[model samples]
Target: MAIYMDEIVKQMLQLSCKLEHTVLNSDSEPEEWVLLLDERQYLMKQLDEGILAGEVLSDHQKMLLAQIHGIDQRLQPIMLERKQGVEKKLREIQRSKTAVDAYHEAGPSAYGAFFDSKK
Candidate 1:
């Protein structure tokens, strides 16, 4: 049980390091971020299961968890910023689409129209 716990913590640590690298060194591509996040979620689930099973973490494991938490703190703001940007872009696209649909519904305008002599 201790060995299994150790392995899980080590893998989590490695993933956190990779996430930190990705956050710092690249453009933070959404696809890559999603994949990493999915993996992290899975590891977290496993960690939770281990804890529920009464597995106690050693000091080293606790330190690794702390390091992961620190990395997460560094990554959170950047991720939120990126998410907001994406959402804003999506809203803009939706608005443009709505305008286009309304225009289509309105149909084409007359080529020419008579002007009123008196207003």
Candidate 2:
């Protein structure tokens, strides 16, 4: 049981480190960020399963959890900012589409006439 808990904690620590690096690196692509998030979720699920299985964390494991919590605090604001940016972009795109659709619905000016009597 100790071995299993240790392995889970180790993997979580490594993944948390990787996630921190990815979040800090501006050059890291969005795809990579998303992949890391998915991995993090999976690791969290594993941790949950461990707890549900009646596994007790050692003192060291508790310390590791605290470290992970610290990383999470740092990550939250950055992730929320990114999410807001994406949402803003989507809203802009939607507005542009609506304008284009309205223009198309107008379907050009059909009733127009111009006359010059003096030639």
Q: What is the number of backbone collisions in each predicted candidate, taken in the order shown? A: 0, 0
lDDT (Cα) of model 1: 0.85
Which residue pairs in model 2 clash with each other?
none
The residue-by-residue lDDT of candidate 2 on 7-110, one tens digit each, is 87878888888988998887766788788778878878888898999988899999998998899899889978887988999999999999767665644544
lDDT of 1 by residue, 1-119 (tens): 89998998899889888887887765768788778878988988998999999999999999999999999999999888888999999999999999767665655556654333333
Model 1: lDDT of residue 29: 81
Model 1: residue 116 alpha-carbon error in angstroms: 18
Question: Which of the numbered candidates is closest to the native, going by highest TM-score?
Answer: 1
lDDT of 1 at 50: 91
Pick out the ten consecutive residues of candidate 2 with the lowest summed lDDT: 110-119
